[model samples]
Target: MGASHKKPSQDDSNLEIYSLICLDPSFHNNEETVKAQQQLRVSINYLKIFENCYQCEEYIRSVSSYNRFILIINDELARQIVPRIEQLRQVYSIYIHCLDKITNQQWAKQYLKIKCLSDQLDMLVTRIQSDHRINDLFPVVIYNTNELNFHFLYSHLLFDCLLRMNSNNKNKFISLCKNEYKNNENELNIIHEFEENYSANQSLSWYTRKSFIYRILNKALLTQNIDLLFTLRFFIQDIYQQIEQKKCLYPIRVYHSHLMTYEEIQLIENSLGQFISINSFLSACLDRGLALFHLYEPNDLQRVLFEIDADLQLNDMNHFGYIKLVNYCEETEQIFFMLGSIFRIENICLNDDEIWIIQMKLCTENDCQLKSIFNILRNEYHYGQDSNLLSFGEFLIKQGYLNEAEKYYLRLID
Candidate 1:
């Protein structure tokens, strides 16, 4: 708990950062506690450790109002700090871990934000992991980008610009990874292996390995963490390139199963005739029956299956693939659609088994009326035919991403 604080980078000032903060008397000294904190850091980007309760309180109060914070405190400090931080608007969820659950539960049960007051370290980790997933995996729908239509012009242009830029700085990216995983031995070794052995050819292999790269990349994309995204652009470009190279040559149908809240369910149901743009890489399977294995009924969330249709014959960036490296098991036939994939909602209905089945077609400019919309986006965003990297900073600047533009130019100067 010495100096593990992360000051938000200026480029990510607009982004909503998620942090896991642990306030323990001596968590770092214990081997098991170190491992648990390592696990939390593996998935979460920012983690702060503090042995002093007073200092943590000051830090929490200093954090921005827009960011999300999850806290873990021992029963000893829970009583001291719970009443103070419980009412703060930035506290998302709190977990009280202690040896005496019976005594702690008596008081923690009344707190609205205390998710769990458990004696089991494993149970405490499970609840935190589940809650973290709910926050990180919340899909970024294109609906909020515009009320007039769902052409997803903003996302399309964003990805278009990032992928086309040069990503040759491997040392810088690897150094960043090393700092983030310094506490975890396993991740540190993987980072070393990557530094010595990585190549452009093994892009997909590395991404599919569930390594630190995969965890941080997806989290950065979900949060629109511009600084982290810039640090990760080298691998991002390589992975997407390999996916593009391995694009299937014929029509393919892939499936993805996900949990959605009632509000998200209604948003898709009512958006049947319109288009919805998904912000991240979609991990889908070629076999519908195989995809069903990921679904389960939960009282709090609805199970939904995505039947995605892609016609690779159309010739566009809307490519999906079955990369051997990304395919964990040959039987799964796992396929993935690239980032910023746009799809028109063809249909949505509940099956007899109570699973919400959705039908969507991967769209290219030629297959639909998106040609006009695409041109409108280019004109509206100042992305003309002559646009190049010279305009990227200007683009970010015009879009109110001044700090991101600053970082982009600084990197260019580097």
Candidate 2:
């Protein structure tokens, strides 16, 4: 399996533009406001004119890149529309033209005053033309009171930005975040510094801090930054506690899917020791059984199997984990271990055909007793006049067990 080494680019055809216009009805009589509104309408009309330029072009949609033109008539409308604009800023390079600033002035890289619509329109066109770099314009973060919980909104915005960045930039951003969080034991202090540094002087509420921490933790895991992940785990023990309490399997899934090195896996296991339940740990081990078997020594794999078996009692069977373990053992050619794992699974959990297939293999390889196989068929499986019984009889003949083959054929005939 080869990984694709794709680098991020700022292609103009891939970029999108969104223009948000919020007109304050309270300033209806003001000449400046009326002029601003008129200028905005004209600007939007000029931008729309490019839509037809791409009709005959192969990339028709790519030509204009203008996505949406939203108009807000009042403060209440602005309040409702600004948060949506903030959300859109993650993907589009939004040029907001409002009678008054709907959000922080520094939200976007460029803020054009709409005194003269013609002048503003020319500036917008010139700015976009000069700087065709998507990285320079994208992920515009805006602060709004619509979502009163600043921490939640900021965290999501930051995470979204981090995801969009290239690997090098993403690592740099994570490093910056880590530096800010250093020596800050207080959660509230960390939140304050994060908000102040990144979110334009906004502060996070106590209740929303946990959500922010969890978002960062998720990003760290996604990027496979074990160091950052461990650092975050130290600060947010409650987040891990919540995952353990809810028995959420997503973190384990993420670990298995992303973390490749044995050292990284060991770090996570040690950090989460005692916090992770035995069942959850066993399930994770089973999920990563093939990887573990390939990466670790035989002793380590045996130790993992022992731990799993110790957690599982004889009467406790029919679990999804057992099924996965048995499959892994079979694929690795550990026949006896596969048989032992199969024994832990309840008979009811398996179909008669499947049971017969496993028994036939065991009988041929280990010379398992005919009486034991018949007991399982008669008592456990209740195998009578079935197609599987006939198949098993033929299989026995192929294995040179003539006497056992004859017994099965006679039973089927009777």
Best by TM-score: 1
Residue-wise C-alpha lDDT for candidate 1, range 169-207, written one tens digit per residue: 689878877776667677788889999988887876776
- List the global CA lDDT of all models: 0.70, 0.28
Off by over 4 Å in 1: 1-18, 23-45, 50-70, 75-94, 99-116, 122-154, 296-299, 326-332, 350-354, 366-369, 379-386, 412-414
Q: How many backbone clashes does candidate 2 have?
A: 0
Question: Over the stretch 1-414, how does candidate 2's per-residue lDDT look in tens digits?
Answer: 011112111232211233433333343466665554444432222122111212312222233322333333333343343444433312223333333453434342232211112223334444443322211111111111122232222222222222222222123434544454343334335445554543311111211232334334433432223234334322333322222233322211210111122332342233321111111111223333553443222111112111222222222211222111112113221101110112111111113322110010101111232334334443532333233434554544655657645744553343
* lDDT minimum window of 10 residues, candidate 2: 356-365
Using all chains and alpha carbons, the TM-scores for the candidates as numbered come to: 0.77, 0.19
